[model samples]
Target: MHSFSIILLPLLSLLPSTISQTSGTFNAMTFNVAGLPAILNDNGVPGDKTANTARIGQLFTQYNISLIQVQEDFNYHATLYANDKHPYRTATSGGVPFGSGLNTLSNYEFTDFARVKWNTCSNIDSADCLTPKGFTFMRVKFAEGVSIDAYNLHADAGTTAADTTARASNLRQVSDYITAHSINNSVLVFGDSNSRYTRTGDIPSIFSTANGMKDAWLELVRGGVAPQAGTDALLCDNPSPNTTCETVDKMWYRGSSAVELQAQKFQYAGNMFLQENGDVLSDHDPVLVDFAWTKV
Candidate 1:
């Protein structure tokens, strides 16, 4: 009996630690809150920024969503998700203004935040032949040296070849930023991208080629291989009844190696910044994903 006990104890000791090195979960939301007054007026959506903002606060309370990456306008939308107890830290790309486009929010204190402007169309150049920087990247510090990145973006509608090209350029640039920096073990990029999967360009290319980055929606929802979907269960409006509008708002994660990604389901919470009326607060819908990190 003693010999059997000795062998069992050794096997148990060999098992990996169940306690996460940096345990605890974080919820992230990406909403395209189109300006303020427009959202409030029934002319836009049933729930204006004010009402939706209140809803957002309530959501934050209910879900305990800490990391929020909001597109459209960071400065203006920041007001919608503010509370004394649940204050948020923010970062925006310069010159974006109240409605200039692109912004991110976070419940964690920002250790450092920087803007990586993508190439964009210019007023000086021919409208069809210009490229502009796209989106803003922010890094937030959590307890115990753990940190993650949130990118807020609104890519140009890929209605034209020029717009598509610009978006591709911006997506690549964001990847460059990630590749250049030494991000901690965990990372996430979320926002409203006017483009869909297999559309060709930035995100698709990155997910296909970038070793570390992978699409959350595709992995968790489409693939059904992860747990994060529980927090992002809401579906975007399918304008075309015959077609399933694959998600445009999404989240991506960095794998253990620049060549391999380790993604799993956390939870899926759909459209956090939504109004009661059918009308959408913004032209696009918001998506939320929660992640649990364990240091290896």
Candidate 2:
């Protein structure tokens, strides 16, 4: 009996960590709260920018989202933070003309936080380049001894050739950063990408083909088939997510050799973010992804 037990001990070490002990799931959201000053943001989207951002803060706790990454948090920084309740969060850089307009709120502790401004931007939009405008990278301690890199960004916006070129540069910059800094690390990249699968010149394959990251929307909601790269109608008037319809807000994730991260659910969660009058809190939808993790 002792001889049989000895042989079994080594074999058990080859198995994955006990699922009940170490595996779990979490929900992460990416939202671009239209937070420009009232005059500048007026007529762009429905609802008061101030009121919408303030309420946007409250929904985080109400929905019990495990973590969040927000963009366009420029003018209404204080208004939104006043109502938010995340114990772990990044301080606002400041208002635009000075701030990058990016922030993160998480249930998990994170470290090595850093921000990088885009090397390029197109003046076609004018407003997109008003801020530092780029992405933030950090190492989030997801669970005891389980760490994953998380990134939040607001890329260049517009549809002109110059705009698309700048946006492509933005995408590649993030991809290069991941390649250099997060090699072989589990990572989650989300925010207002402003790049769509069906949009020409938006180069969405950098994440999948270059970094091996999986798009939550494509994997969970679109049956793993990426929409063909070309221009298509984007119908985002409703809260219900359509298989064919993709939004600018995107979430990309990848698991390392030690930990396997898989997204079980991906959704356009705008219903809970609407004002009492039914106007949306922001022009872009708040995308939520539920991820499950286990040792590989």
Candidate 3:
């Protein structure tokens, strides 16, 4: 009995630290609020900006989503709606009033914040031309000497060749920024990418290879099914039998070898943001992902 106990104790001590303690868990979401000034009164899709803003706050409370990346948040929505709610925030629209439409809100205090406007955009798409689309970088300190870099972006939206090219360029800029700025390679890029894993382009490939990041939805939902990617949880509006869903809003993460990142759960929070009359809060559904981090 003494000999057996000695051998078992040594084997147990050899187990990885992940088997003993978990660092923490946090939830992240990427939502395109579609809070543009022109679309605020356009029926139930956009809904009333004020009411929709309230619903957005409700979503944060209901889900306890700690980190959020919002796109198309114009008209001081980031300041009026998010600043008071998130506590930690960064927002910019390229110095234009209601222009860039990118913001990052976090439960943790931000150590650093910056915005990078795209050098080029789709000339054919008037919407893209009017709005100054770009990516925002945020550094949040979770603990002493522990931080994560987050990049929020909203790429050009369209299926045309010019639009696709612009999207690829946007992705490249993001990748380059990550390469240059991300400390310890622990980073997350989330927002309305307008590019999918199934699409044929450098956007997906650049992230998979250059950034060493995995799509949170694909990595967690499909049971780690390599090369398989799809997000049909919810589309622009409420869930319907005839509604066709696609993967547009997404989250990607990369963790160092010392820190193991696992996706505990992923869901579409469109239902939570719906009005009592069944109207959606925004034109784009929010993608929420819960992640568990452990020291390896």
Best by TM-score: 2
Least lDDT summed over 10 consecutive residues: which range in candidate 1? 122-131
TM-score of each: 0.69, 0.90, 0.80
**Candidate achieving higher TM-score, 2 or 3:** 2
Give RMSD (Å) of candidate 1 vs. truth. 9.1
Clashes of each: 28, 0, 1
Candidate 1, after superposition: displacement of residue 264 in Å?
4.3
The runs of at least 3 residues in candidate 1 whose Cα sits more than 4 Å from the true structure, single-residue gaps closed, are 1-21, 36-58, 81-85, 91-100, 122-133, 183-185, 200-203, 224-245, 255-272, 276-279
Clashing pairs in 3: 93-100
Candidate number achieving the greatest lDDT relative to the actual structure: 2
Candidate 2 or 1, higher lDDT: 2
Better of 1 and 3 by TM-score: 3
TM-score, ranked from best to worst: 2, 3, 1
| Clash pairs, model 2 backbone | none
Task: Evaluate model 3: give its lDDT.
Answer: 0.72
**lDDT winner between candidates 2 and 3:** 2
Model 3: per-residue lDDT, tens digit, 65-85? 788888877763743354246
The C-alpha lDDT values of all candidates are 0.54, 0.86, 0.72
